[model samples]
Target chain A: MHDRISSLGEKKLISRIISRSRSVFGSSKLMGLGDDAALIDAGDDYLVLTSDLLLETRHFPDPGRPRDMGWKTVTVNMSDLAAMGSRPEGFILSAALPDLELEFFDSIMDGVIEACCHYQAPLMGGDTNEADEIILSGTAIGRAAKDRVLMKSGARPGDLVAVTGPLGVGAAGTELILSGKSTEGFEDAVERSLRPVARIEDGIILAESGLVSSATDITDGLVSELGELMDASGTGMRIYEESLPIGEEVPEIAAILGMDPLELALYYGEDFELVFTAHPAGIEELSTMMDIHVIGEVTGGGSIEMVDKDGATYKLQVRGYEHLSPA
Target chain B: MHDRISSLGEKKLISRIISRSRSVFGSSKLMGLGDDAALIDAGDDYLVLTSDLLLETRHFPDPGRPRDMGWKTVTVNMSDLAAMGSRPEGFILSAALPDLELEFFDSIMDGVIEACCHYQAPLMGGDTNEADEIILSGTAIGRAAKDRVLMKSGARPGDLVAVTGPLGVGAAGTELILSGKSTEGFEDAVERSLRPVARIEDGIILAESGLVSSATDITDGLVSELGELMDASGTGMRIYEESLPIGEEVPEIAAILGMDPLELALYYGEDFELVFTAHPAGIEELSTMMDIHVIGEVTGGGSIEMVDKDGATYKLQVRGYEHLSPA
Candidate 1:
């Protein structure tokens, strides 16, 4: 096991897999692999496609929460489309299921249906197979104006970095679930974690506003995702730590778990919010239409650094839940 | 275990999953569930999407042959597109890997890349996660002329049912693998099982010819697939038992295993061949172009029956490998 893929870590393994030459078909791949989502060329628009896998043991914090798993699976895929600033057209799923109670299966599907309904991503049919574990693979297709699509590479020095909502709910809720903590006033955090919303509307609004420079949804921790934006754009981001919108329950949950709320906000991930950079003028205009939190600014430097209210700058840790890596 | 889903069978389970009202999203689904492949309406063409799951234990005859599994995974998805008379646009895959050897993973991806190269379905890169087993979910996107797309419900009475090529190779190859038999002269059968072609060119030509009335790809077996066409079109078929293009190796393999080649040809699925119904005129033209096996004729009767060379009729058994059921 030590010599297995886990030792290589998720990033390395993915890099290795996608590093394979993509020139398979004759036509050029507009955008596939290594991007927020795969984009296929249409006449006047681009087709956004993304896929995510959720395994029972790997993704499900508690085995009894099949419904959350279903919702999260679909939401995760949609989140990728949101990152690319597209509206979902349809959903395709392939599930490897185990022999389980009918209610468990039904509950999972109910959550899947509910999420698909809420997101306007119609559930197209998928394949099902008997397996040792519940393996859900979700693919979502969406469309956006060819010119309006967001990429991770367009951020500039003057662009202001923003997020759609508070973060760390997923990390906090998962902690509470694993710890068997009481679900008292922390229900919001748990709800957000179990049923995170894809920022589809905000993404579309941002892309159409033509004010945004770059964008990506925060599936991985903020720092990790920001790293992607930074690396892709060949730029850096200077964060105002005080401006970090840590979840309401994050403080209490961090205290309860003896962790740092800022750490949860910056690195715990699972916040299905959009982290984007846009012109200040566009932010002022778009802020009236939707909630926007300007947390940082893109910079010319090549490293992501966070500045405290006291003016101390520190390199942010790039850590999140990486698949195929040791926990 | 007795109360597990296996008791429900693959057909029942799939029907139950897809039976959920596709009215989740308001925009009418072009062809989401219960179709050969889900179709999304574009300007002048339909984008076809299909996803299939291949489990390590269930799909791989020899774990050492990760290469074959990778190839089959892509080929199977393309096979669905072929059934719909669509050409490959791109391929997306989500692989759930366990703590695996790098060589094993590399070989699987190599096969995947090679197949994508061969089929002109560019690799659009997908997700990878660590799991308890190697669970591969492959989704293929294809495009076809909206007017020329084939459907299972279009076969009318008097149509001739034809196949792209011979059958039973999948069955024989699998038997050879499972039986650990010497594959001296049966390499072709084994090869077909491992690296089956997705009849894409033939399907496009058939669809464009406007002679095809109905079609489906053989995955569950010829009889089961034919039964699907029969049920969907509300028409029956009179298959000539003598005309079945059973692989030449099937007879020897069957004799070696003390089994009947006809049973293997009829019931053991995974041939990946296209079973389509076309007009007699189209068949004449298509026959001169590509390999076409005239197996039967669509009838107004309600049951699929086989007419032996002896002139006796018998109901073709509709049994194939059903997932989620005791094999």
Candidate 2:
């Protein structure tokens, strides 16, 4: 208790919570915390439950855009369910709002309802309280076949590591907004950032095909999510930087901001895309169904390394989310 | 859009949300918003889910007591489940923490774990974020037999109204702290406020016995909760003021503060006790198992009235929780 939480870091603090919260009545929990979502054994189908918190100025780039804030709040929670290969059943929104206009509240609710309609998830009831700032906590529940539920484990060497779609657009969107740059040419980046959709269909396909091994959503950057998958499966990834699907607007934003597009793709998170490892044959079949980028291969090596077009390899740094800090 | 949320008030805003959020995903939702908890129709059993948010300065009387804060966060959510006669299976904490000491963090976790153990609910998983304030949102998931699921409906005229336990201690505790009074003579009141436990067993017994017609938890004062029950069940209540089991220190604290003890019991809430209506025979059977106070009878007159010791009858005021405000 004397040790500062910042000294321990977010990863270690999360580890501490996961271990300490292990309770006695745990017969029905197929998977507890620390994964994309927790799993409960609900007879025939496993109940997939996941929650995510979003603060107004902390998570969003603008305080005036309540609609986007509301949209992202639901998507972030559903993305965890998607990462688990589960179909979202319902969403529970827990909001703490400060004093605000009724119009802003409606706009936020409009965004929430729009997302619910898009995801085909019901807006279940929620709890509300008054606070100094706006904080949205969304808990999404989904159901997946007991056998088809995915986790951040079971990856084996020789499997192909792939992403459901491109990366960096979300980061670019964030960059553009933070930099106050006009979105004249890079509107897609801002759009992707505001209305990012989870790869739910791809995750379900991966689970049903039974070809995928370990999977996680790329919300906290590729390297960080890969670190989680590797830790859970006792494996590492050898990523080929050249094979990645970088967003069309990523390079332009990087050039304007004097940042490397590759760096944005690798470390700047909030993409909400699926990263999975599957057999080569499974990758081929999945490619026929939907677009995917085979960016690497699973390996027994204990460290994550990336190989560039020049065949130069270096360690991929894993910087866990920079949210929590010590007092 | 032009109206302020505070101008609309909490009740109207909540009603607007419930109506507007009616989504396309309809099946499997036994009960949606506007109840003690939401119910999902899982195959053999109903999955009960509820969430309650606590703010550092807003909800707690003291921000220094993290343990009580944690304990109350879990209890308040579980109280919702208890109102529905559901057995809590797991508790998920959605914490938006600030730059606080690690010791404070651990102390909160300790309280969470302690409550989970007390209620026999596993600490499932949770989502955490760093915010400017400490916002603890606790979500509890429970399960109950589909037939025995209780809701805020189904009361009938001539039914006896009862409470699982005494009231007013929690309000007394709040008054003492806010008034900055010494607790030397009112330690029990403060204790009750800091450590209120939901009447889970009583709710279950009332549900399983098939005698109780309706139930709701007294979290927002007896009158407020009773008003909810009345509105939902299309019946009013006739309470006997002399029959109420006021907490031991309620009158003493009221005397010291120059307030009525009955006011604390009637309008001051946070008791986490069950208020249910049932048949007289069932009350007899339940009385043998546990102590209960028969406080009133359900009436078809569509008005909540109370009979005092002097045979005076008057309308019982329903002041809903005063939290939300217009910005």
Candidate 3:
């Protein structure tokens, strides 16, 4: 029944987005995100190719800041490549703009540009169109060493679980922002939610170690993603609730909202952090380069369970957004 | 003022769209169109990657037919790989659903599954999320013979212009459907518009011939795509209007709608038809295997013109969607 939206006039918006996206990083890019197509070097065997679509209303809050939306699109796709243990070579940014304002697109692309430059990734090629709504789809191509690519099925029982950054901060921070709470002294938490950086460094380091078992990004927060890892590997996990690295600001925000801090940390989504499992010996070396916290261990059971600080354990329900769940 | 529009709930609709896409193509796909990550094969030396985003109000008319939306998302990306003259291997579909419903997404994926089977393409992996409106994005991977690939810049002046199928039907059919005009006895026109087939076979034949000067799909329409070919090669072209192989039903529809037939034929987008320039010597051979049409010839100067029935020639203006134009 929704027929009001039309692709009438959005030229200015598309231009603003395209111009700001000109800034990209990396050396192997023969072309970067402006042409009908982007070409890359697919060395020897294969190239890790991925394209992700980030909608304004679904991926982030509708009234969310444009900078965060732009940053999240690139970061999420980069996280996809990172999970594959690949180094980005280039990306194609296809944007469908709803409005034609320079300010609107410039702010969004500013975040995208910053993220690409930070990750040493370059925009390779993409399409841009004027639609009734804002749509950003990115195709990123990365490379990986032949024998070292990690996968979800690589985790084994007895493997130690670790995370690259503190868990639940992004969801907690977003909850605060959505509720109109002040983020004056909590900029880090807000940034964690808005511009949650992909663990590119950790992905590379983990891939090279040869001992890390498996890995994936925690975009859907800790509970959902951890369960995914366990499902993929055909193993169960026992997590320690007290061991979660909740952001310092989360407690303050939770207290302000009179919400349960643990639930905010557990159920909220869009973390963009990395959850990985490896041998306990690798933690010391990994901690030198990243803020990794040992949160759990793989076990023989068929389900996931979390033990609270009070020495009580409970079954972790599959409560996050499941792609196949009934509406 | 648009802040309220931006803050609407979108991700809530994606679950319905993705659920309709489960295991339709029959594969042991580690993941397909819902998970945070997808695992696929690392085939040979190269992977063909293509992504397309179809907006509900912009790309299609509302109340948006979910079936056509789903089908177009998959076919459009498939068309890109076809433009590259590559064989379909696998695809990952990501979508933003406006709400939770099985009917729309199911019908759409039904079209997608049919196309995949028709082309022998497989479903590999993807992600899904709900959004404020329906936006379908698909990433397709194909394998190409490294050195045998064709590029848009390969076209040279003096080459003969060719197209794979009839044009203007898609635009006309969509107009009929959207305008509430009767599609009775216009079944071909309706199919052409709702589900324009990608020139996959012609692409293969063209690639194998080693004769195509340069190529691209008639996405933005005949005139605009030809402009792209000319822009890339730094050449111009002249076409005889009477030589264009318009579909038989196109004229009838144009007459009923009281619109210019030639204009509709030239400027209609989403044709998904292939247009290429090749050496005159390959004309006879190429005509046998495909529905090849010679509408014009490439000129030394970088301009495009069409000769009317009266033999008066005029410059052809590009009138398709311009990405950077101000809204």
List the per-model TM-score of the A chain.
Answer: 0.95, 0.95, 0.81
**TM-score quality measure for candidate 1:** 0.96
What is the DockQ score of candidate 3, to 2 decimals? 0.10
lDDT of 2 by residue, A1-327 (tens): 366566766666676777787544443552747788877768888888877788887888867788988899899988998899999888888888876788998898888878887887888886667777888888888888988888898889999999988899999888888888787888778878877888888888878877788898998888888888888889988999889999988998999999999888988787989999988998999899888999999999877999989999998877644567343
TM-score of 3: 0.83
> Can you write out model 3's per-residue Cα lDDT over A1-327, one digit (the tens) per residue?
422111111112222222322322222331222211222334542356667777665556533588777777888888877876778755555677764355576567666656666776654344556666678887776777646655665678888888777756787777777778777888877778777888777787787777678777766657766776787688998889888887777788888878877776766757766788887777667777667889989887768899989989988974553433343
What value does the lDDT take at residue A315 in candidate 1? 84
Q: What is the lDDT of every predicted structure here? A: 0.84, 0.83, 0.67
Top candidate by lDDT? 1
**Local lDDT at B198 for model 1:** 85
- Give the Å error, residue B179, model 2: 2.6
Candidate 3 error regions (>4 Å): A1-46, A61-65, A282-290, A321-327, B1-46, B61-65, B321-327
Itemize residue pairs with steric clashes in candidate 1.
B221-B269
What is the DockQ for all candidates, taken in turn? 0.59, 0.61, 0.10
Please give the distance, in angstroms, between residue A115's alpha carbon in candidate 3 and its true position after superposition. 2.3
Candidate 1: fraction of native contacts reproduced: 0.62
